[model samples]
Target: MPVEPDPTRRSHESWRAILDATFELLEEGGYESVTMGAIAARAGVGRQTLYRWWPSKAAVVFEVFLDKTNIGPFLAGGEDFPTQLRAFAHGFRTLYVEGPAGTRLRELTGAAQTDPDLARAMAEQWFEPRRAPVRQALQEAQKAGVVRIDIAPDTALDLVFAPMHYRLLVSGGPVDAEYVDAIVDLALAALAPGATPA
Candidate 1:
């Protein structure tokens, strides 16, 4: 008798193909161009397969963004909190300034304004999880006396990340290394343990 293929391995392969196809389509033609049918065709899987995994094109695309743009490695840089933060900022700046991923993010940001479900999915899947590690790092810094204990980790994270988002979504300013460094410097100064007002 012929040996049977492993269902788990096959399922993993199929999922990878679907995600890869979704990104390829997104890079090729923006958000409006991607559809379940197109992703299935590109992945060489059936439409039923795509639908079985994701309810919509936005769902598929969001999963791809989460998998592809994980900032974990970026957050693990340098010898100290300030250095690590600067590295993270540079990584974030580069991601948004230099790839199809940025285009996809911008599309999603605009779509989220009109689609509450998409907005919730992004917040729950992408935003919260990504921020968790950053928050943990901040907490650790505070414990080590490098960061101010009084300020919430969420506030510190906002100070570090908000400028990048503003530049990406609103101001349309340059997110170059210099700009990223400046943001990191300002954030570090504010987050320093003794910087709080008396």
Candidate 2:
């Protein structure tokens, strides 16, 4: 069902209205319930308007999450990679592992397993851009001799963050600071130059 949205909203206001309406529909039901017609009706925008900006329903839904979600890890990288990594991990915890967004993530993850468009849209529109800064930070650390060059930054990110995703999606484990620290500790130690085998 389309929620009541200000039909008069336009331009940037229309954009916000579109996203807001998408979020409302998501809350009212779930991923399955959100449709282009409902979104257009709710936002008082034409279906073409949504298509003008985003390719699909999943794309529009992802946009709402991106728009509402916090801009993560204020300090992109730091002199202390460990500290930076901790903050980054915590940022992920807060954004994708903890609350409403986290719940959406878990839901969409399962949803994506079936809907190829959603899978592709989530990865391309949502995950790819966000991963860049963190990857750049890792690359810089590697160049600075702070991180081992042998491991790719992408792989490092996966290693550092996979457990958080696992906890949120698979294991249903706690993603507290302690768990983050444990993952960081093990990951950094492995990624340290001249590191010894345990």
Candidate 3:
């Protein structure tokens, strides 16, 4: 007699197909072309399955996007704050500028413009979790007397991070390894204790 399928394995496979299909669709037609029905059909899963796991296309999209971004703590350079900043910036270069992460981010962010729910999900799910570790690292550095405590944590995050993003989305400037090191160094100088805000 034939054995029954393993429910756990089957479930995992189903979700994997769904996730893969979502990205495939994203690459093919972008955000507007993706719909729940389209994802279900492309994934070879039932519409009910999509609804069971996620409420909408954006929900599933962000969920899968989050899975792709398990890069870990942003400032994992070294024990020292300066070292950590350098390492973090280099890692950002490798992943965001050098790798495909930046493209996916540009796509998601642009799509999030019209969809409030998607924007919120992207922030609450994708952006905030990744920012948490970096934010925590900054907090620890503040306690260590490396980063100035006067600046808000979120502001500090933007100070170091915004440059890369600006280049990625707006300036179309260089985002090379040299630029990464320069930005990190600039951030360190600005955030150094007793450094006055301009």
Candidate 4:
């Protein structure tokens, strides 16, 4: 009798292939060029297999972005609020502002403006997962009195991350180490207890 193969292992391999192919296409040609059929061909998987795992090309690209970046580990680094915030900010900048990933992200964001479905999928699949660790870190900071207890964790996250996004997506400013440190510093100052309006 022939030995049975592990479905779980096969599934993981297929998923990896799909993501790798998606990233390669994104790096080579941005979002508009990355079609489901191309991804399937490059990944050596069926188009149906791609559809079975994801709803659209946008979804696959966002998932690939998340997989490639792996923001969780960076957000989880360091013990204190400032340290963790710095690490997360730097990691975010590296992933979204320094390379091909940045260009792909900007392309997707532009597309999301007209495509509500893609917008929702990106928020659910990419934004939420990336935000969770930062939210948790904020909660911990609040509990430890490092961050103001008055503000919601989500708001705190916005304070910390929104400027980076604005710089990357809208302002066209440099997102270098100095900028990251300044953003983290200002955010922390605002979140500190008894902080005053500047």
Candidate 5:
């Protein structure tokens, strides 16, 4: 028996279907192999629908990257910002270190080196959103007089995240728990007044 399509499902089905197809294509064939026609056919959607939603394949793939990964540690739950920040760090390390998606991330980031548009979109859409929670946590830390207010939030974010990106993209080293703890400690130290590096 044919399953009756749910109307609510139909409304957002195309978007979900598209992302699902993107993941499949990415896993099976990598970023270079993904094309609009292939994605549309995989999703069972029309080319017009795909074009209407995403201006380019890069945008579609970026969205799929966001959807498949947990951006922050906590999912907007009951924990305080700091606790959630810790959780977010843990989650981030898990994905960046051991997850299957890490390889795809490396490849896409490599491709972004030549593709300016993808690089911009990846930074704006994928990277910025991931940092938002840490930004909030830093703000909270400032209000509590734990973090020096002189340092800008963006700077704080960079201090905390830049190392991980450097390791992931450039150094090609392992992202272990010890590394995460060291990163958190160093970033926090920079934000502390009269704090000297040990």
Candidate 6:
């Protein structure tokens, strides 16, 4: 008798194909045009495969969006926290400045405001993971007497990241290396021990 296919492994492979196809489509033809049929065709999987996995095209696309971006790996640079934090911001700025993924990210963020599920998923998946390194760095800085003991890690992350997100989302400004350095400088000033927010 022939060996049977593992259902779990098969399912994982199918979803992976769907996400890969979704990004290809997104990169080739923006988020607005990536249909379920297009994804299925590009993925070489049946349309039912896409449906069985995701609730909607947006959901599939959003997942692909996350996979295509380096929200985590970029944040966790190395063992050292400060170097990791700077590298994280630097890497993300490079992506925002250079890749098509940035446009997709902006679209997803705007959509998240109206789509509660997308918003929640993004918070749980993309946002939190990206903040983990910053949180770790903040904790270490606090321990080292570099940052104020009173400031929470989460707050520190927000203080550092919110401006970058705001610039990316609304101002449509260029996210450059200079911008990264500035954000890091500002974050340290605000959270550093004996320093007050100006």
TM-score against truth, every candidate: 0.77, 0.76, 0.77, 0.74, 0.72, 0.79
Off by over 4 Å in 4: 1-23, 35-56, 66-69, 76-78
Candidate 4 on 1-198: residue-level lDDT in tens? 111224754487788778889888887887888899999999999999888767778777767766765444376565787888788888888878767767777777877888788898777766777777878888988888888898878888788688888888888888888988988888888989999666
Clashes of 6: 0
- Model 2 over residues 1-198: C-alpha lDDT tens digits? 112234564377788888889999999998889999999999998998888777778667766776676555434544577777777787777776556887777777777887898898778756776677778888888999988998778888898888888778788888888888899898988889987556
Compared with the true structure, model 5 gives a TM-score of 0.72
Better of 1 and 3 by lDDT: 1
- Per-model lDDT: 0.78, 0.78, 0.77, 0.78, 0.74, 0.75
lDDT of model 5 at position 154: 90
Cα lDDT of model 1 by residue, 82-151, tens digit: 7777767787777677777677778788778877888998887766766676688878889999899998
Candidate 2: where are CA atoms >4 Å away?
1-17, 44-56, 73-77, 196-198
Best by TM-score: 6
Better of 1 and 5 by lDDT: 1
Give me the displacement of residue 117 in model 2, in angstroms: 3.7
Better of 1 and 6 by lDDT: 1
> For candidate 6, what's the RMSD?
5.0
Q: What is the lDDT of residue 175 in candidate 2?
A: 85
Q: Which runs in model 3 stand beyond 4 Å of their true positions?
A: 1-14, 26-37, 45-56
lDDT of 5 by residue, 13-129 (tens): 777788899899998998889999999999998999888766788777777877776444343565564455556666777777776667766776887888898898777766677
